[model samples]
Structure formats: structure tokens, C-alpha cells
Target: MMNNAKHYNLSLDKRLADELKSIGFIRAEQDLSMWCGKERSYFSSMRCRGYGLHIGSLTLMAARIADRMNTTADVRERARLRMALNIVNAVVQEKCRLREQELLTA
Candidate 1:
């Protein structure tokens, strides 16, 4: 007989981190270092109660970067950036359940 053992899944926080990282959320080494240099409580808050906050911050950062890249580009690039920003906004606002003001300040 084949053994059927139950497998435990990761907690929601870890899952969120994995998903965000998998979705092209790359940052500069300096930015990553600065972010990492924060107090452990910051990561703990993100890991525990700030999943939405982190998602908001990531999406906003992506949008900001896209805007900078699109400044001297063509319409096609702007459209692409718009779409990405919109999707990020929607995900952070709806899927991640972030309040508008909280997301804005994130």
C-alpha cells in the first residue's frame, strides 16, 4: 500500500512573500539593503499584519519606476505602464484588502 501523509502548507505571510517575489518585484541592491536594514519589528509587522501594506508599497514602487522609464518613451510604453499600475492598484486595493489612505501612505 502507498503511504498517504498529510503535507502542511506555509503560513499566509510566507505565501504572500513568495508570490510577490515571483511577480517581478525586483528592486535595486541599495534599496533592498536599506529595506533590509530596518528594525526586525518592521519585517515582523509585514509578516504578521502588514501584508496589504507591503503589497501596496511594492505596487507603488513598480509604478514609480515604470513612470521614470516611460518619461521619454512612446505611447506604447506609457500604456504598458498604465496597465501595470492599474493592475497593481487593483490587487493592492481589492485582493490584498488595503484601504485607500493606507495604501497611499504605504
Candidate 2:
């Protein structure tokens, strides 16, 4: 069970990184922090702690990806961005549902 969870986390990280790279966040932590409006090393710290991006950061990323999609002129690139946005949106929704469930149980 622990291994499965770890694998899932790693896959999620890779997927998010790939999407971010696709949309021009290629300068590692610097660009990612800037794009997500976070302090330098924020994301790096989160990853080091085995805690993936918070919901707020994910929300910000989704919004930026949507904005990029709108301004993108190439249909293929727009479609790609749209797909990335969809993935981020789904993750956000899942996180929200989990939070709601936690609150209900509490």
C-alpha cells in the first residue's frame, strides 16, 4: 500500500511537471515559482517533504494554463494546453472532494 501511494505521488509529480514544461515553465524551480506566484524554493520544499503542490497552487496553475490556451494561436498547441488544463481541473476537483470528506468525517 505504501509503495502504491508513493508511485502514485511520483506519477502525479511527473505529469504536472510535463504539463508545466509544455507551457514554457522550463527553467525549473525559478519559473515554476514565478508562474505559481510562490516564493522561490516553495515548490522544492514541498516536494522534499513528500507533499505535492497544495490545492491553491494547483488552482493558480490551472487558471494560468487556461489563460495560455486562450491566447495560443496554434490549434494544436491550444488543444494540448486544453488537455493539460483538464487534467489540472480534475485534480483540483478530486482534492476538493477529499477535503470535503475529511471535514464531514471530522
Candidate 3:
């Protein structure tokens, strides 16, 4: 029973990965026809299709680096380090909550 369940789960995970690969990111097909204009293509003023994604990635990268610097190095003031740690903890807690909800729904 355990072996069969494990195999089924592995196959399910593989199928999901394949599906995601084929579909690509959800924002890859972002439409600007709603508030901007009636167009399926990206805005001419925008740099790329993943600017929003890139912004999120950059924010996370900076937070992780700053947290590490604050903890490992003794450069930041006590108040600043405390605020950074609080932000990190909040993000982690939110992620955990989201995962729990996902698992429950699944």
C-alpha cells in the first residue's frame, strides 16, 4: 500500500511539473486590454513581460541578503535588525499559512 501510494504521488508530481512546463508562467499571457487599451500584446512603455515577477524576485533577494547581513555581521543597529527579523518572520508565517491551506484543499 505504501509503495503504491508513493509511486502514485511521484507520477502525480511529474505530471504537474510537465503541465507547468508546457503552460509556462501565468503572467506570460498578461493582457493590457482591461484598463490600458484594447491590446493583447505588452505595453510599449514596459521593459519586459516579467517586470512584475522580476520586481518580486528582486525584493525577496534583497530581503534575504539584508537579513543575512544583519544576523551574520554586526553592522546594522539593533532596531534595524529587529525590524528586518520581524519582516522575515512575517513572510515565513504567511508562507506557512498558505502551504497549510493548499494542503488542506488538495
Q: Please name the candidate that would achieve the greatest lDDT relative to the true structure.
A: 2
Q: Candidate 2 — worst ten consecutive residues by lDDT sum? A: 1-10
Better lDDT candidate (1, 3): 1
The sequence of per-residue lDDT tens digits that candidate 3 reaches over residues 37-91 is: 2244433223242221122332453365455556764544544444534443444
Q: List, in order, the clash count of every candidate structure.
A: 0, 0, 0
Please, what are the lDDT tens digits per residue for candidate 2 over residues 51-81? 7677888789789988999998999989877
**Each model's lDDT:** 0.43, 0.71, 0.37
Instruction: After the best TM-score superposition of candidate 3, give how far the Cα of residue 12 lies from its true spot, in angstroms.
Output: 28
Those runs of model 2 whose alpha carbons end farther than 4 Å from true positions after fitting are 1-15, 18-34
Off by over 4 Å in 1: 1-53, 62-66, 95-106
Model 3 alpha-carbon drift over 4 Å, by segment: 1-76
lDDT by residue (tens digit), candidate 1, 1-106: 0111101111333433344344444232233213334443554555454332355455555567466556847776566556545444544455343244335655
Top TM-score model? 2
Cα TM-score of candidate 2: 0.67
Q: TM-score, each model?
A: 0.36, 0.67, 0.32
Lowest lDDT 10-residue stretch of candidate 3: 25-34
Model 2 clash pairs?
A: none
lDDT of 3 at 35: 15
